[model samples]
Target: MENGKLDTRALIQTGVFTALYVVVLAVFGQLGALIPILQVMGPFYIPMVCGIPFMLFAARVRAFGQITIMGILAGALVFLTGQSWVVLALAVVLAPAADLIARAGRYRRFPLTLAAYVVFSEMLIGMVVPLFFMRGDFIARISQRHDDAWVNALVNLTPTWMFWVMIAMIAAGAAIGALLGRTLVAKHFRPAGLVT
Candidate 1:
């Protein structure tokens, strides 16, 4: 990018990849909403599915801020989907850290990019923030969308202690997702010369 600022091409790429990431997140997120079991397991699978687009985006990143932009859009997407603002807040914090991690590698080192994505993926923890920090409000907000019985069932299914478990799951999923994305990039993108 010229003058260390993202130009039109980078912004356009950010938009396209962010849109892909949002679509992927929304589709999987809805599955969790429809199925409590899936919701419980969301920390594991959602990040994994999102890896493809994220890795593709990472491949195209020529300057800083692209990952952060995607993270902000992702946060906004979650907010638009009726989640608390915590997601957005976490994005503000975590996305920049991720951006720095990638910048350390000049966005060309695969391992650093993978680590950045894992960190970026942790922003999803905001989804669970309310469960621990704002339980009453979380329940109140969720109750509006789901029946009390379903809400109760979900609450019962996810104990407060499980928050830590969810964090671990998110981390594991992010690692796997990054590896899977790396593999795909190697197998397909590299051969196709889509990324170097």
Candidate 2:
């Protein structure tokens, strides 16, 4: 009976954390619109901040399923709250990928795994999704606006440079998330007995 009670409490906590993640994403989405370029820039770090609590919760509770569910819920809530449905859909898809990468970290391999999380999350949510949703003419227009220099620069870089850049940004974001998560877990979650 005691074990059952603990399980119930943990579940409730998980739900609350998931809701919190959604709220954070919604808030960030509003920020993203106010600064669309920041959304594309790859190092905005908002998603990383949002993922921290969930990462810690996953580590302590060993509940990757709950974390993944929370990511989906976060994406959905962000969409329902007036974010673009296309981006929200991407978020729903990418959040699970991020959760998988984080879970694979097993609370360690911080650098590599977190990098994967960031890259995958950003590419899916930032680049590829936008590529599809945005009109080709818009991309061309932007390319022309830059005097073709931007596209030329990309063309000049190594074939995988774009991919690596995305990965690097993800790594940066994950590092930020990990640091903030540590602080938050220590300051609030630990004191509250919510995490180890």
Candidate 3:
């Protein structure tokens, strides 16, 4: 508690969770590439799968800036893998949102924690939205490296109306995930003294 620093145990837990989050992201990314329908429904998978680690991280760290660090690390890793910087930027933007939710709950409120997990999931999974917002620019960027047919395939897959539909799906996944996290927390983390 001195100087607002994390104790060693908390630091270790946060690091482990952050690494887990990145690994899961990478796995889902590869899976998305392999499966067309899977790629179209990333929101459903990312939030549901990744939200577990996020809730664990939030519970253990229970401090300011932990989510931000996790987001930055994930972003940096994604960038190193040759992905766009925009995803990183979105993650960073939403980190504070998670932080705020955690703070308001004092990091212990199950309901607020669930909400935080939902928002956190949105941060990482929402990166696909640039296609809907900046349609021409996104297509042009993809066209630079990918062939026109590839670009066309991508565009056709992501219809204009599907953007909001995807968001709703993500939110639904988040709710499902947060509920699962709550159950896990009550059954496992609390009993094991992982969360107070």
Candidate 4:
């Protein structure tokens, strides 16, 4: 709080990971388009493996505002890319939560860092939460570009009842991703001086 600025290294690392998050999200988005099920299922699985850069940022950039800034940049990029901004909303919540989790570990605790990434992964479920409350609007919005058949398929595929299933998947995916990230941090990032 004294400086109100991230160190040069932290700033650069945040930019790198923020961009990484966007690129990974974009690739998964294409997969989502090719496989509609990915829209519902991708979050739980994708972050678990793809969050290497994120977990590295989490470990290395322990500045007070680092995670929040990185999250904002990532969210803005997602919105610019035309994905729903709902993930941005979730990032606001998840960023600080991740900070708290990392703080609990004293910033270098591997388990706690992994836990933080799990929180990062949780943001994916937020993408689907709108489906429960704004089903009609979502249908209407999608229908603008997509036909009735596709819209109907999406609606039927992601009913409110399935929200629970999606939540479970998100949790499972987060746990797996966190574990894998921990391994990566220990094996590569730590040795490479990327994470402390």
Among the numbered candidates, top lDDT falls to 1
- In the range 1-196, model 2's lDDT, one tens digit per residue, is 1112235565676688777766665566556434445544534466577657655655464455554565566556656664446655666676567656665665345564455445434522443333334546445745764556554553344244455565566667766776677677778877988654
Question: Deviation in angstroms for 17 in model 1?
Answer: 0.4
Question: Which tens-of-lDDT digit does each residue in 129-187 have in candidate 4?
Answer: 66677777767777897787767777778877788877777767777776777778899
C-alpha lDDT (0 to 100) for residue 79 of candidate 3:
74
lDDT tens per residue, model 3, 1-196: 2124655665666678889988988888777755556777887877787777777777776457777677777777877886767767777877778778877877777788777777766665546766788788877876897687667667788998887788788888878877776678778888998775
TM-score for every candidate vs. truth? Answer: 0.93, 0.60, 0.81, 0.85
Please report, in order, the local distance difference test score of every candidate based on alpha carbons: 0.88, 0.56, 0.74, 0.72
Arranged by TM-score, best first? 1, 4, 3, 2
What CA RMSD would you report for each candidate? 1.9, 6.4, 3.1, 2.9
Model 3 lDDT-worst window of ten: 1-10
Q: Which residue ranges in model 4 land beyond 4 Å of their true spot?
A: 1-5, 191-193
- By lDDT, rank the candidates, best first: 1, 3, 4, 2
Off by over 4 Å in 2: 1-10, 41-43, 84-120, 123-128, 131-133, 136-168
